[model samples]
Target: MTKDSVAAVLERLSRLYPKNIDLSLDRMFELLKKLGNPQDDLPPVIHIAGTNGKGSTLAFIRAFLEKSGKSAHVYTSPHLVKFNERIVIGGKQISDKQLLDCLLQVEDANDGAPLTFFEATTAAAFLAFSAYPADFVLLETGMGGRLDATNVVKKTVLTLIASLSMDHEDFLGHTLAQIAAEKAAIFKKGAVALSQKQLPEAQKVLETYANDRGVTLKSEGKDWKIFISKEGFYFNDTLFPHPALKGVHQYANAALAIAAVKELNSKWLANVTDSQIAAGLIDVVWPGRMQPLKDFPLPEGWELWADGGHNPGAAKALADFLPEWNDKPLHIVCGMLTTKDSENFLKQLAPFADSIHTVPVLNALHPGRSPADLAKIAESSGFRNIKIEDNISHALADLTAGRYAPGRILICGSLYLLGDFFSSNKGVKNDRQ
Candidate 1:
């Protein structure tokens, strides 16, 4: 592959727009018009938006649909390892050649237009989905839902909203209601909207938005519920196996996905069985979320884990799961972007972690907080023992120097940091597949 490769094309596309995120659909609409409005030709779209658990919920939905013998075209953002991981067609990651061709075609149609990288690449994804065949298109918003590039789809089969929180307040809004409205904007008329458990303020806003759009809203606690029993978990009356993914929040994520699948079966997957749902629950694979790192350069009896949780909501989830590792003292290796709420994020996890090691996310598109600065934040967040490391390598070496007892080491904070780790460290398997 030469300069026309997908990576090269993506790099060139990044410079097409001056601002990284304009958060407007005008440029995306214009680009789609040039490409014959490929978004209109896609299969039944399942548009998802929220603060946290969007990716995990989508993963569960994909697993359920695929196990039921259905193929879907998936689009998600912030690729951990490669850009190709963001787009999957018919149960397969988009090939480099195919992606390159679509990107080049989009570039040609774009004709050097000033669209954000997300908008341009999303245009390419829609183009590829239009040219391919699939039962559904699982579209995830890159940022806020109202003006997000992926929200160009006029109609959708089901609109799913995961747990909403305050993460991107700068672009979305300052209050929870404001952010909720931005995400609830994805709801289309006649499209039944389903949401996971939400804060009271967010739930009220979502209800108002759903009513204004004449869309039926099915909420987790109100419309349906997941009950945990001595044996296993159940989504309403249907029994489900425990989710393969770690963390207790996965039960709620799985329930939301199972509900979405049930809603889809009436029109699309008519023959999906409860057995299939159980299989999907255990077969799902979502990387960089409480992922266990094995065969890495850690000493014996020492464990390494990685997650992309950068917000307070995600930190709460991590803190909830930390108690499970009570046998091992937890040492945190964290790196975050300058845009995130590092203080609140650290505050949520500081109570659970024994020590905090701050590092910088290498080669991130956005600027990362310096290790020294992050250490200061950790100190302010109630972490007494804080260390500033040059990078993950240095942190790992120091942690394994036999100074402290052998325990678990978690590399978390930003998805970009996890991506850097995956790219730089060799032979460290996280079982993403």
Candidate 2:
């Protein structure tokens, strides 16, 4: 099959199966068995699972490994522009021909068993990684870690859990402990587990789980810690360069990646030079998490920032970074899926936003909170200046027309929303388009 044809076939397969995310490992395991267990053939794996910051952490790891002249394969989810963005081999995205070939191979192996879009794509990634020669493979969980398809991997050199927050409540659970427990399921026996600084309840839950499973638990601030200063950050006993990714919360995420690599201490690549770690931290880039789009349809000196933060914990982290605005009025363009906590998310915006503009995300799978409904939520959350626009373009137009300030424009809420925004701005039609 040709590259376009391969993509078309995968698209068709995605549409054929229901997109509703079923939280279970049975289907993926069965599918992998039929494919001759390709996942077991992957290189030294670094399995990262969390509600937020997982993608950034993976990016950091990839950047550092590449700096050290090591080849790394990465698999992430919910591509911003193209499906090919999800799979990378040897630090490069899979070519069209390679993607098509992998897809065809997986389709032929499936033998008529139904698989979700994510499941099929993951299978294709593992197949590609197994076929290729690389130094390491970084895997990020799609949803809840415990039952996530990526969890089937038996042995991981290291596992890092980033900030755990309340998200996907209907599928994962309602409370924080419940969500933490699900994420902690990624911990494998004898594998080193490095956890970011979590809440008291979540920390206790993860520690207990790791101990019970005989996994060595390295909780942030106890086993290791990151100290951020005006100059940079100190990881463990070493004072390393600051992270390339913006935001104060990123320091912790970068430290987690470094700790994971340090724990591995591969004899083949022993003694990771400080220069490699520094270069990796500086060069790493993860889109849609505080990504700045400098050249948008906005006036000069007007800034636009996009993030995929949707829950209360993510909002609080964003709020902590807001003080750097230096009193510049922030114009927020926000949209969210119906399953999210709209009220809680909006309330966190009160401190940073000068005015809130709400809009419906285009082509979202789940029902989205209408601009009007989100405006109501914003008002009730003590945000007095609230406006509802049909979509992002109109919202930006109105914000630019009004009395402006030397401030940034924040576009946030849902990852799907951010993907749509990027597609619209870049003139590329994605799955949603």
Candidate 3:
């Protein structure tokens, strides 16, 4: 019998449990127990959770750690192109052989018992992280933090919370405070918690939780502030180099990472100098969030970019950054999952776009809203001159044929669509940051 590839093994393991997301730690704990509870042996954890900016924040933190001569084992979810992108040991993606071996071991430990795909994969990541030697494990919650598969860590060195907004309404609660409560569960006693500026309601929830748990919570604006300028941003009066990642929002993300690093400098993560933090800011790369597509063929003066942001909060971030591109008229090419609030998401972007091109998220795991449906949503969201296309390539071809002024083209919305864009477009490297 031939050995199964990583893809085949992942597909088989996915069938061992229900398809829908059942946010609970029961199955995860059970599997870890069978595997001798590798979660307990992991290096000091920096658990992160929130609606958006989790990946970008984690990327910034990893960059800081690497710059300080530290190696970290990191785990994030929803790989854009390959499954291996989700797991990194010592700042490198998990090799296929090691990933397959870990998955097989996790499969054996499960003995065909019930488990979600994320739970099984997360278990494999923990096992691998435990075996490997690293200074810290930077863990991003798969979904809501309270019952997320990665929340199995009993104690963490610190908990980082990024921007919070309405997302995953079904699994996480609908209200902002409820969602904040769910994510704030990651704050452990004796661990410092840091958060980005949040809505008043969400802020109250997080503050209440932190106070009850006796965790010191430092929030943006209240505790630490980032002052942006034409040259660069300042974190709590300490000026830092501009981040390599695009957009003004990144300054806040970098500040959050810097704050976490400073909070840990005295104990778990020492020797992270100001110079190292500045270097990390300049070198950090978090692809698919307003990343330019330099390799794709384009007419002279025409620019192409992509962002994997499906929620209104992400859309607002993109909207805030769009004004900086006033030199060129911006045209948006968007594809979204059916589960997303397409109208709300488009509403945030509608004001800035000269035209909106709607397409289906071809590579999404679940069904995507039809192009026509998305266009209708865009229209309702106050966008005019909306066009429906088969996919991204067709959208670009249409844009080229239109001979519109050499404006900017932004492929926005679902991460799965971004994955499809990367897969179809040759020379586009999906570099894991």
For model 2, residues 1-433, the per-residue Cα lDDT tens digits are 2445765868666764645656677888887887889999999888999988888888888887878778889999877767788899998888878888878777777765667777888988998999999988999999888888899887587888999999898888989999999999999886788999999999999999998999988878998878887878998778888786778888988999888777766433535677889888877888878877776757766888888888887898788888888656888899998889988988988867888999997766579988988899999987888889888888888888856665678999988888888777774222211
For candidate 2, what is the total of clashing residue pairs? Answer: 0
The TM-scores, one per candidate, come to 0.97, 0.93, 0.97
- lDDT of predicted model 1: 0.88
Which ranges in model 2 have alpha carbons more than 4 Å from their true place? 1-7, 16-22, 266-270, 427-433
Error of 1 at 323 (Å): 1.7
Q: Name the best candidate (by lDDT).
A: 3
- Leading candidate by TM-score: 3
CA lDDT of every candidate? 0.88, 0.83, 0.89
What is the alpha-carbon RMSD of candidate 1 to the true structure? 1.5
Candidate 3 stretches with Cα past 4 Å from truth are 19-22
Q: Per-residue lDDT for 36-118 in model 1, tens only?
A: 99999999999999999999999998988888889989998788888888889998888988899999989999898787888
Question: Which tens-of-lDDT digit does each residue in 335-358 have in candidate 3?
Answer: 999999998999988888899999
Please give the clash total of every predicted structure, in order. Answer: 0, 0, 0
| Candidate 2 pairs with clashing backbones | none
lDDT of 1 at 433: 28
